[model samples]
Target: MTDILPLAQLGRRIMVTGPTNAGKSTLTVALADKLGVPAYHVDLFRHLPHTDWEPRPTEDFHALHAAAIAEPEWVMDGNYSEILPQRLARATGIVVVDAPLLSRYVRYFKRTLQRQRVGALEGGKDSIKWDMIHWLWHTRGTAEAHRKLASETGLPAVFCRDQRDVAALCAAWDLRLSLS
Candidate 1:
């Protein structure tokens, strides 16, 4: 039997992990607002703000990620797997967004074509790239790894498998979309 935990049960330090364009950031913000905790977007720590998807130095990004996890309460969004162990150690629960690959591709292209995307780095421009298309193609199987990690750590996990699942969860939690 599948166990689907309620949003409130995810606790204060929730880790929202998923492939790019899978709505992880949006869910993180909603969870944070519902829980009255800070929301952290891992992309912000990994990339320099106000730039065209430029990455920060590896050490600098690691430092920022460490600091964010050290916070007492937060809902973090992203799947930086290299440093995932440390984050998982501090996380109380996990939310894994497993939207369909077609949906992900559509979201990626739509965001890139739009003037301003919700999760794009502040002041960073969104653009379509062959590399990103390749990345999207390889996003498969990531949600399973995320779920396995949560299981190993004995942390409960909630999975949003599609837009309908997301909507149901949000409604059940009484969560309001901040910016959608």
Candidate 2:
């Protein structure tokens, strides 16, 4: 939380990274809600029309992300490799949302099932398929890779390993803003 204060005070662009179902979207939305700034969910930019998992063109993805981060205040959420350099370049901070592997897998399963039952997914996309569940599990390694990348990118980052840390971070962020 202390690590986040400076970035929030500065109103810097940020990228929230984490494993699937680790609450990256939740945290990004919360931050944007608190700061009253725009938050871009990269999934919105990535997912193609009428397709479940097909990604958009690389050029289009970069253009879209470039446009989003061009703004003064924004928090972007995703782990698209093609956009990482530009994202890291513009990011004032990074928050890595990490939870235990077992916990994350359970969350992933529950979320996928919930989405399927509701016929809704992120970005108004259709419910995810069973194959997507396998993809989510594979994403576990990507989260670790991003943690390393964030460390090397030199952005001020806060890694929350569990729900307690997440709550603590939110509470501290609230306190900081109140005192400010």
lDDT of each: 0.82, 0.70
Off by over 4 Å in 2: 1-10, 49-54, 116-125, 175-180
How many residue pairs clash in model 1?
A: 0
So what's the TM-score on candidate 1? Answer: 0.92
lDDT of 2 by residue, 35-80 (tens): 7789788876776655555778878877888899888888777777
lDDT of 1 by residue, 99-174 (tens): 8888888877877787545567888876788988999888765767766766678788887777788888887788
Prediction RMSDs, each to the true structure: 1.7, 4.9
In model 1, the Cα lDDT at residue 69 comes to 97
Best by TM-score: 1
